[model samples]
Target chain A: MTALATGTGGVGSCFISQLTWLSKNLPSTRLSLCYISMIDKALYRPDYAEIDFDTALFTLEATGVEPPPISTIVEYLAAAPHNVILVDNTSAISLAEAYPAFLRRGISIITPNKKAFSGSYQLWQEIFSSATSGGSYFYHESSVGAGLPIISTLKDLVQTGDEITRIEGVFSGTMSHLFNKFAPTSGSGGKWSNIVREAKELGFTEPDPRDDLNGLDVARKLTILGRLAGLPIESPASFPVESLIPAALENVANADEFLRSLSKYDNEMEEKKLAAERSGKVVRFVGSVDMLGKKAKVGLEWVDQTNPIANLKGSDNIISFYTKRYGDMPLSIRGAGAGGPVTAMGVTGDLLKVLCQLR
Target chain B: MTALATGTGGVGSCFISQLTWLSKNLPSTRLSLCYISMIDKALYRPDYAEIDFDTALFTLEATGVEPPPISTIVEYLAAAPHNVILVDNTSAISLAEAYPAFLRRGISIITPNKKAFSGSYQLWQEIFSSATSGGSYFYHESSVGAGLPIISTLKDLVQTGDEITRIEGVFSGTMSHLFNKFAPTSGSGGKWSNIVREAKELGFTEPDPRDDLNGLDVARKLTILGRLAGLPIESPASFPVESLIPAALENVANADEFLRSLSKYDNEMEEKKLAAERSGKVVRFVGSVDMLGKKAKVGLEWVDQTNPIANLKGSDNIISFYTKRYGDMPLSIRGAGAGGPVTAMGVTGDLLKVLCQLR
Candidate 1:
C-alpha cells in the first residue's frame, strides 16, 4: 500500500502526474495508491481500496472528507494487509513531528520535507532509531539539493568508507538565482534590490522575500547534509548564517514595503560586488560543511570566476564532495535545484528506492 | 558469501583496502568474504569460511592455489549455504562473457568492469534477462563515471518517468587532461603532442597513450548510457569515433616510436585550437547521444570558454543530461571519473546496494 500526503498545489500535483505514469509502466508491481490528502481534506477507503492516481486530484476536490489526525493516519496505514510506504511531499511541521511514530509502527517513509531531518537533533535521532527498532525504511533524498543526487552520493561516499573532508555548495536556488543575476561572471549586473524585485516578480522568491533572504532555507539544507557527512549538527540555527535581509528591513510591514526600501542599501551590495570584480572573482551565496573542523556555515563569499559555483547558470544547484578517495578533486553534481516537477522527482525516486527493498 | 576477482594491481589493491574499511564499519551486516582470486591464483574453502578482509590479500599471497575454470567457480558459488555477490574488478573480456552464466545460477554481480555491458548488445540483453530469470540482482554504477553517481542519477531520472532528450560529456579522464593542457581556456597552451607526453608521464594515460587517444573508451561509456536512456544502441563500434592518432602513425610499432614522431603533425592540431580560439571557444573531446535524433557521436568539439567542460581541472570528467523536465538547462555531474580508489568506491557502493536487497 502507498500513501501520498501533499499540499493542494505545486509539487503535490506534479507528483500525482508522475505516479500515474509509473503505475501504467510498472503494472507488475501492483502498486496501489491507497490514501491521499491535502491539508484540509483527504480521500481513502476503510477497506484500503486503491485510488486512481490520474483522478486523485479531481476526486479529492469533488468528494474528499475531513482529514484524520496524524495518529489515526499512521494506524490506518500500519494496519494494511501488505507493506506500507508513505510519500510525504508536504513541509508541514506537524507531519514531520509524526515521522518517528509512523516508523515505530513499521511504516516506511519517503519524503522531500526538510523539517523531519533538520528540525532538531533529538528528532533526527528518534526518526532513525525508530526505523531501526521497527525494521522500517526511511529516505529523504530531496531534503537537500532537490533531485540532484546530493544526499545519496554523500551517503555512498560515507558508506563505502571514503573519508569526506569537506562538502560545499550553492544549496539554495533563490540565492543562486539572485547572485547569478546580480553578479554574473563576465558582465556587470543591475543593482541588488532591482534584481530582488525582479526575482519576486518572476515567482522565484517566497511571498515574503525575507524568508529566502534570511538564509534559513540554505541553512536547513546545510544541516541535513552536514549530519549526513558525519557531523552532529544541532540545527539550522546552530551555525553562523549570513542573512541577506538588511537590518532595517527585518521588521517591514510587508514584502512590497521591503522591496520598495531595499534600494536604499544598494550601494553596500555594489561595493561587495565591485570588490570581488577587482580581484577577478564573483560573489556567490554558498553553504559549506568543514568536516575536519566540525563547522558548518552559510553565507556570501568571493568565488573564483573559474570555480563551478561562480559559473552556475540560472538557479541550478551545485554540490561538491571532497573526500579522501577522490583526492584533490571533489565529486560534484549540478542542475535545477527547485521546480515542482524536479522536486517531485526526488520524492518519486525515494519511493522507488523504498519499493525495491520491500519484501 | 562474497567473492572478489581482481587483477592484483592498481584498482584491485585499492578495492581490497575499501572492502577492509566496509567490513569493519558495517559489521552488523555480517558480510563475510569467502573467496578471492587474481589471474594466476585463488584462495577459498569448501565450507565457505569467512576470509578476513583485513588480511585476505596477504593470506592469498601466502597460501593460494591455481585458479579453477570459470564454470567450476560459478558452480561452487551457486552451491554456497548463503546468497553470493561476486565482485568483478578486472576488465577481462573473457570473464565479462561469463556474467550471464553466473547470474543464471542466482549469483548477483557488482563491478566497474566496462566490457560486460559495453561489449555486445546481445550480451547486455542476456545479462539482464538472466538476472530476472534467476531472481538475482546486478549493478555496475562505476561503468560510466567512477564513484560520481552518473549511472545512478541517469537511471533515477529515467525510472522516475523523466524524458531524456540528450546526453553529452567529456567522458575520458585522459582526454580531459590532454585537451585542458593543450587548449587552456585563459592562455595559450603547448602543442597537443607535448601535452599527451606529459599526461603519460603523470600516469594519467594508459601505458600506450594511443589506447586513450583512440576514442573507443569514451564511445563504450556513451553506449552504456545511451542504452540506459532507452536507446537500443547496437555497440560502441556501430557509431562514428574521431581518433586523435594521426593516420601516418596509426600502425606505429610502439608507443615510444609514436611519441617520438608525434610532433611532426602538430600543425593540424594547432589549426583546430586556433580556429576555436578565434570564436572565443576551447576544443574538447566529447561524446554525445542525441535521443531525439537517435544518434550517438564521439569527437572533438568547440565549447564555450565558460562551459563547465572547458573549465575542467586535472583529469576530471563532466556529463550533462538534457531532459524535458529540466527544460533548457541540462543537469550535469563532474568529478574524477577514473582512479583506483574512486572506481573501487563505486564497486563497494554497488555492493552495499545489493546487500540491502538481500532477504
Candidate 2:
C-alpha cells in the first residue's frame, strides 16, 4: 500500500520514526510512502515512487514543492495502481473537512485528528458513507485518548451487540494534573490557581493555559466517544460543557494577563473543593455520557476516593466504559493520554490495521 | 468468509449469539457458518452453504455426525472458495496442538483457548511460522485477561517499536477475588480457607478450587505476555510459579474433600497476610515479567496500597505495561477479566478484525 502524510510536528516526527521501524520489520507487508508534506511544502514523484523514510523528512524540508489543492492530491492518490492510505497528523479542520473527497476516491485514512470526527454531524455522516461507497476505511483511534484503547474498546462493544450504558473518565492530561494537584484525595491540596500556574510552568497545559481551561478539549473527546456509542452528537458544542475560565478572565488581552487574573477567582474553586472534602470526596475534571438519557457533559464532579477517576497517578488519563456485558464495573484503560510517541503509536497501530485489510 | 467452530460450552454459546447479531448488523460482510462441532460431533454441508448462526448449535447437537480426523477437517476448510476462519472455544490441548495443521492449510483462527498460545515454546514458533508461510492470520485476545485488551495492548506497543521493560498484573479473576477478599486494603479479612470455600460456592473459582489455587493459570497468562514482549520464555513450567495448593491437598481426591480440610492450613496464608500488613502493603496474587533480566515469575507479592494492582475492585484484573515510550508510568488496563459474554466479546472482536482483512 502507498502512504501519504501531512504535518511535521511532534506526533508527525514520531510517526515517521515508527514507520521506518515497521518498514524494516514487516517483510510481508509493503508500505511505500509516495507523498510527504507539511502545511506549505510537499515531496512526491510524478510516477508515485516510494520515498525513503529516513531521508524524506529532511529532504522535503530542504527542497520541496508547494502543496497542491486537496482535489488534486486526491486525484493523484486515486490514480495509483495500489491501495492508498492518507495519514493525517495535523489537527486542522480544513484537512478534516476534505476527508470525504479522499475517501470517495478510494483513499483510506488513519488519523489522530479530533476535528474530523467531532466537528459536525453532517461531515461525520459524509466521511463514513464515502468510505463505505468507495470501499475504503477511516479510523481515528487517538482522537479521544491518545494511544489508549478507548475508541476501539467502545466500538467493539457496540459492534458486538453489547449495550454501552455510560462512559466516564478523565479525558485530558492537563486537567488530570490540575485537579489532582488542586484536590488530591489524601488531603486538601493547594489552591486551584497555584496548581494551574504550576502546571503551566511544567508544560502540562497548552501554550496558553486558558486553552486547557476552556473545557473544549475534554468536550471534543466526549463528543468522539459519544458518537462512537451510536449517539448522533451534532458537535462538540452540542452539549453543556462547564468551563473553568472565569468571566473575569474570559476577555483577557493575553495569556499572561489571564493567568494573573485567574487567582482572583481562586476562592470560587476553593469552595467547590471544600464542599467535596466535607463529603469525603475529591473533585475531578471529567467527561461523562449517559447513553440511556442521550446526554454528555464535561466538568468538575465530586468523586469518591476509591473511584478510579480520583485514584489516577501523575497526568495519566483514565477512561471507564460501562457496558451491558461488563455489568457494574466498567472496562477501563489508563496511561499517558498525550505526548509525541504515544499519540503517534495510535496512528501507527491504525496504519497496521489498514495494512492488514489492504493485504 | 466461511466459518467453522469447535466447542459449544459457555464462551462458544455466547460467541454464536454475538456472531448472529453481527450477521444482522454488518450488511457488507457475508459470514457463512459452514461448519459447527462439539468434541464428538460435527456439522458441515457438502456444498458449503451457510449454516444459519441463529440455529447452528441446536442443529449441530441434534443431527451432527461424528467428527473425522484433524487432517480431514483441515482439508475441508482449506478447500473453501472463500476465506475460512476457525473459531476454537475448547480448552483441550489436543485441539490446540492441531492449530499448525489448520494454519498450514491457509485456515485462519480466532480463539479464546489458552493452550495453543501458552503451550510449548516450539509449538508457539511453529504456529506463527505456519501462519506466515500460508498467508493466514491468528488472534487470541481472550487467552489472557479475558476481553480487557491486555493481549492487544501489549501487541500494539511492541509492534509500534516501543521497548517494554516490564509487565506486572493480576491476570486471573479467581486469584484477584481471592486476594482481595483475604487481604483487602481497608482491613483484615476472612480466613484464607473460608474465602476459597466461599468463592468456590459463588462459582468464581473452577469446579475444583485447587485448579485456581495452583497458580498455573496465572503462570500460563504470564508466559503469553512474556513471549509477546520479545522474551524467549520456554514454557510456563520453565519459570518458577509458586502454587498455593498445600502438599497434602495437592493429591486430594475431590474438591469437596480438599475444601473440608483446607482450614487446617489457614495459618500459613495468615502469616503472609500479616507480614504484608506490617509493611503497610497488601498481599496479592500476581505475575511479573522482567524483560531485560529475562525473568518471569508468578506468585504472591506485597504491593503498596497505591498500586493499581492492589486497588483493583471485585474480580477485576489489572495489567500494567512498563514500556520505554511510556517512561515511569506504565500503560494499564482493568476490568472484569472473566465471564462468558466478555470472553466471547474478545473472540467476536478478533473475528471482525479477520473479516476486515479478508474483505
Candidate 3:
C-alpha cells in the first residue's frame, strides 16, 4: 500500500512516479497498491483490490472517500491476502503514532517520515518491539540523511562488530545551504540576514526561516542516529542544540517581522565567521554524536578550511562515521540529502529489502 | 559454514576473530564453521558439524589433512543440511573458477576476491547465471573499495532506477598511497622512486611492487564496477590502462633488482609532477568509468588543488558516483578501502546480507 498527494511537486506525488517505475521494472516483485490516502480523502477497496500504480494519484483525486480511522486502516491491512508494506510519505505525527499499530498487525513500513523514529523514546521502543512481536520489518533510511546511506552503513558497521566511536555531519539541507552561502570557503559570502532572506526566497528554507534556524530539524536527526548507535536518547530536546534564532526575537509575531529584525544580528554572525577565518578555518553548522562519551550536540563549529564539512557544495549533506574498522579516517558519505526523487529512492530501496524477506 | 587459515598476521585469522565476535553479538544468526583450511591443509568431518569459531584456526593447523579437490569440496558444501555460505578469503583464481560449480548447487558465495568478478566475461556470466538457476546468492562488496559501501551503494542507485552517468575515483589503496606521497596536495612531495620504495618497506605494496605498478588492480576494479553499472565490459584488458612501471624494468626477474633500477624513472615522474604543478594541480593515479559513453580507463590524471581526490590522506580510497538524480554533485564514499580488518568487515557484512535472505 502507498499514499501520495494530488498536488504538483509534492513529495507524495513524486514518490508515486518512482513506485510506478519500480513496479514496471521489477517484474518479479508482486507489487500491489491496496491502500492509499491523503489527510482528508483516501482510495482503497473493501475487497482488497490492487490499485493501479500508474493512475493512483488521478484515481485518488477523482473518486476518494474520507480516510478511515487508524484502527480501521490497520484492520483492513491486517486482513490482506499477502504481506503488506505501508509507505508513509506524510510527516503527520498522528500517522507516525499509528506505526506500532500497523506493525503489530503484521504490516511492514517504509517511510521518509522522521517523527516515527525521532519522536519520544517510548515510541521508538514500542515500534521496534512491536515489529519483533509481529514478525514484521520496519525501515526508515531516509529519516536521518534523506537518500544518503548513513543509516544502512551505520547498521552494517555495527552488525559487522565494528565499533562506531563517533558520527558527525551536516544533517540538514537548509542549514547546509545557509552556511555554505553565508560563510563560503573560497570567498567572503553574503551577509547572514540577507543569506537567510535569499534562501527563503529560493525555497530552500522552511515556510518560516526560524523553523530551520531553531535547529530542531538537525537535533531530530541527531536524536535518531544516537539511538541507532545504541544510545537511548530521550528525545531531540535531551541534547544541547544551539538555536540560531536570537533570544531577543524568540517571540516575533510573524516571519516578516522576524526578517525585518534579523539584520540586527548580522554583526554577531559576522564576528563568528571572522573569528573562524582568523584561525584559518571556516564555520559550518554541524551535528555530532560522541558515542563513547555518550553525548550528542548540534551547533556551529570552526572547521578547518580543508575539512570535508567546510568543502561542502550546493547544500550537500556529508556524514563521517568514525569507527574501529575504518581507523584514523572516518568512512564518509556525501550527496544531496533531500529531494523528492532521491528520498523516494530510499523508501523504495527499503521496500525492496522488505519484499525479499517476505513469504 | 566458515573457514580460515591458521597463522599470525593473516587475513583469514583476522576474519575468524571478527566472525567470532559476530556470532557472540548477533545470537539470532546461527553461524557455524563446517570446514577450515589453509593452502595445503584442510579440516572437515564426514558429517557436517559446527566447528567452534574461536578455535577453528588452531584446530585446522592441528588436525587438518590434505585439502580435497575443488569438485569434492563443492559436493561437500552442496550436501549440507542447512544453507551454506562460502567465504573465500584467499585471492585464488582456482577457487574463483569453482564459483559456478558451487552456485549451481545452491551454495551462496561471499568474498573480497576480485578474480571471480573481474575475470573473463564468460566466467562472470556463468557465475551469475548459475546462481540464478540454483536460487543462490552472491555478493562481493569488498572486490572494490574494501568495506566503504561502494558496491552496495552502486547497487542501490541502479536498483532504484537512477541513471548513473559516470564513476570516477582513486581505487587502489597502494596507488593512492604512492601517488599521495609522490605529489602531495600541500607540499613538494618526495621523489617517486623513494616513495615507492618507502611504500614497499611500509608493507603497503604487493610482494613484487610491480604487481601494483602494472595498473591491473585498478583496471580489475573498474571492470567490476563498470559491469555492475550495466556495461558489457569484456575484461580488465579491454580498456586503456597506463602502467606506471617503466619499460626498461618491465622484464626484471626479481623485486630487489626492480627496486634497484626504479630510480632511473624518477626524473620522468618528476617531470609529470612538474607539469601538473604548473597548472596548479596534483598528479594522482585514478580509474574512471563513463557509464553514458560506455568506456573505462585507468591511469594518472591532473586533479585540481581543492578536489577531494587531491586532498585524500593515507592509503584511503575514494569513489564518486555521478548520476541523473544526484545532479551537478556526485555521491561519494571515502575510507580506508584496504586492510585485513576492513576487508574482512566487508565479507562479514555481505555474509549478514546473505543470512537475511537464507531460508
Task: Provide interface RMSD per model, one decimal.
Answer: 0.8, 0.8, 0.8
| Candidate 3 lDDT by residue in tens digits, A43-127 | 8887888788788878888898999887898888888877888888888898899999989878888888899899999999999
Stretches of candidate 1 exceeding 4 Å from the true structure: A1-8, B1-7
Q: Once superposed on the true structure, which residue ranges of model 2 sit more than 4 Å away at CA? A: none
Local distance difference test, candidate 3 = 0.87
Q: CA lDDT of B183 in candidate 2?
A: 91
Error of 1 at B149 (Å): 0.4
**lDDT by residue for model 2 over B1-359, one digit each (tens)?**
55655567899999989888888898566788888888888898878888888888989989999987878888888888888999999887887999999888889999999888899999999999999888888999999988888888888999988999999999999999988899988977999999999999999999999899888998889999999999989999999999999999999899999999999999999999999999999999989999989999999899999888888879999999999999999899999999999999999999888888776
lDDT of 2 by residue, A67-170 (tens): 98888888888998788999999877888999999999889998999998888899999998999899889989988789988888888888888999999999
How do the residues A1-359 of candidate 1 rate in per-residue lDDT, one tens digit apiece?
44544445688788888888898887655577778888788998989888877788999889999999999999898888878888888889999999999999898988888998999999999999999998899998888877889899999999988888999999989999999999998778889999999999999999999999999999999999889888999999999999998999999899999999999999999999999899999999989999999999999999998899999889999999998888888899999999999998998898888877885
lDDT (0-100) at residue B9 of candidate 2?
86
lDDT of candidate 1 over B19-103, digit per residue (tens)? 7777678876567777788878888899888887778888888898998888998988888888888888887788899999999
Kindly indicate the candidate among 1 and 3 with the higher lDDT.
Answer: 1
Q: In terms of TM-score, how similar is model 2 to the real structure?
A: 0.98
Query: Clashing residue pairs, candidate 1?
Result: none
Per-model C-alpha lDDT, please?
0.89, 0.89, 0.87
In model 3, which runs have C-alpha deviations exceeding 4 angstroms?
Answer: A1-9, B1-9
